[model samples]
Target: MNEFPRMSVRDTFARDWYLFRLDLLLAGMPNKKVAEIRKDLRIELAQAAQDGEFRQALAGLGPVNVLASNYLEAHGRKVPRVWAGLVAFAVLLYGWLLGVISLIEGLYSAADQIRPDATVEVVRNWLFVQARVVAGPEGVDSIGFSLSGWGLLGWLAVLVIVPLICASVWRAWLPRPTADQAQRA
Candidate 1:
């Protein structure tokens, strides 16, 4: 009997995790073809596992991004990385919010320092949002925050940052060059 040694649970887990991530990154691929490729990969992985080279085999396949790109290119499909784009959008939105908050806080603190209890109005009116930090002799009396409209900077941000994000997502969407091609470039 020529029985191959079974892989340890850790090794099995490592292989399974890699394949699972590969499966996720292979989105936009034809289900049947994707299944076929995954099946074939499993067979190859099984052989490598018997030799206790499971991790190395997984690494040899390359990063999930490049591997997915290769498969996608072979199938003649250029699928946009929708998930990544969405994530980027979310991060930008939240980051901008944080920036606005910090700006308002700093302005208020500065005013408080210059005129501790004096009547002061710190208004930062942007294209769409208008923020007013008012302080009376008794310190900060009221905080006024409103969404007026998209300011010039807001439009500029949309124009500049948005295209850059799209270009980035698209660039990431496109197939990556092989190591040799990259070296040459």
Candidate 2:
């Protein structure tokens, strides 16, 4: 019974700390920034535990939600809202574009699996039947279709550039400071 209670308390302490860490993350601070805050907390907790004041330390940290809000209030404003929003939008758009590409590739794979012997004529005819082009306001007077190497290259360039641009923006908005800078601070 004594051992069971001790184990329970230990588990609760760990669980609480994990919840605190996640709450910090939920405050919209970047992962690296949250980790830095959590690291300091863990150090404090360890010191308290060494002094047999673990429970006191936990109480001192206060409610996880409140602590997170305070943390965001203090540190989250380093990045401007417009820049952060733009970075988030770019990331989401990049993800959506990747999903669209994946879906198209999956469909093409399935089609290939279904008809391995399909010729260019079959694929072209299928495209002609499915794809519709409208030239005027409502409908096109005529439909013409062409697939070229340059078109494929253009798509590939977009696929590569979109993610690169998003990554650059994300980094700019939430830069992971170097170890030297962190330590100096």
Candidate 3:
């Protein structure tokens, strides 16, 4: 006959405790509160018998879906606002990065138009024409590129700085987490 090692009462409790905590989190119980509640439950479970009694006690907590539903329905408003801000930030960042990439691509396209066979004067004249069409009558000024490095640097700064600024603003606009939400963190 083969013998298998029996699971300890503590081990059984630990496994059930972990599963319960996960269900609570998925149900929207904040992290801090979940830990506290779990601690209290562990003490209760330890006092109970390790056989059917412990299992029954765990089942009495109710189903996982009910726990999650209760938390989300109570905090639905705050959750949607957080999700909206995150989505807005994502959209803005994507648009900004796309604009920057398009600008770089346009510059490359103009450079490619210049052939090795073309004379310097011809190249300069062709570029002048292309710039006027692409950058408007103001040419380089319209495209924000000057002989000095400031044009590229300034736009780069805008690209990097804007997202951070918007993110800070979004965070500030959010409602403070409630006692319940904080527990669910």
TM-score against truth, every candidate: 0.54, 0.35, 0.35
Which ranges in model 1 have alpha carbons more than 4 Å from their true place? 1-6, 113-185
lDDT of 3 by residue, 23-104 (tens): 4344333556556656666666555544536666666756755654555556532332333445555775577566555655
- lDDT tens per residue, model 2, 123-143: 222211222222332222333
Candidates in order have lDDT scores of 0.72, 0.53, 0.49
- Residue 53 displacement (Å), model 3: 14
> Every model's Cα RMSD, please?
7.9, 11.5, 11.3
Better of 1 and 2 by TM-score: 1
Please give the lDDT score for candidate 1. Answer: 0.72
Question: Highest TM-score, which number?
Answer: 1
Q: What is the lDDT of residue 125 in candidate 1?
A: 61
Show the lowest summed lDDT stretch of 10 residues, model 2.
120-129
Global lDDT of model 3: 0.49
Candidate 2 regions off by >4 Å? Answer: 1-12, 15-27, 77-185
